[model samples]
Target: MNGTEYRDHRLFKGTVTERGIIDYILSLDESLRLNYNAYQTIVFTVTHRKPNLFRSFIHEKQRGLSAKMDQALKTFRQSEIAIVNALSYDYSNGLVEGINNKIKIIKRTAHGYRNFSNFRNRIFIEYKLLETKTAA
Candidate 1:
């Protein structure tokens, strides 16, 4: 595993391969290449958690870009504060989100149980928090 491998994974290598494909496609059109490069800069800034760099790059480099990129930048600007907070802090809601996703999957698979107790029991069973009560 090489080229920015993490935990023995070659994710960035895959990214590089995909980027080459995109670059080739984008190079077919000058406008598309420009747009792709601009978008890549934004992605790099965000990935590195550089809000200040993002602000500067958006202000300086994003002028006269495509309408779609403008809309995306507008959305990012609107959520700038939240984005900055996310980049600045190490807090995560991943555990809670994972549990919520599991519950949703369970609900979908069950197809609407009529009894709430049974639903709760299913959750407890999934989490291994309850044992089956067998009759002798």
Candidate 2:
């Protein structure tokens, strides 16, 4: 599910108290829950900012929480700086991936291309059409 759906249902984050079980889960330790909310916020944030606050908070939180939480935090701790850097990394395989997907579609649907030159021309034509479409 998407963000809103998960927050409204799975996270038990809503005004309605019809779900007593969910309420109990959240009320177990309200402060811990608040800390987790902050942690999750840091994890989900997309900006190119280093998570200095998050790194410190995780250390403090790991001391207080369970072994299960410690395990997860351990993984994050190992890649702490990398996680922060991921926020604004420009390098991506998305363009190549998109072209690969289009190439696969062309290979699957088209027939009678007996030579590699014919297949190459078809792929070039596809890119040319895409370029024109984007230019317009």
RMSD of 2: 7.4
Top candidate, metric lDDT: 1
TM for candidate 1 is: 0.69
Worst 10 residues of 1 by lDDT: 1-10
Model 1 agreement with the true structure over 23-133: per-residue lDDT tens digits: 557778877777777888888887898878877766664554789988888888888888878877888899999999999999999999899999999999999999978
**Local accuracy of candidate 2 as per-residue lDDT tens digits, 99-130:** 99999999988855789987888898888842
Per-residue error (Å), model 2, residue 131? 12
Cα displacement (Å) at residue 119, model 2:
2.1
- Pairs that clash in candidate 1: none
Pairs of colliding residues, candidate 2: none
Q: How accurate is candidate 2 locally (lDDT)?
A: 0.65
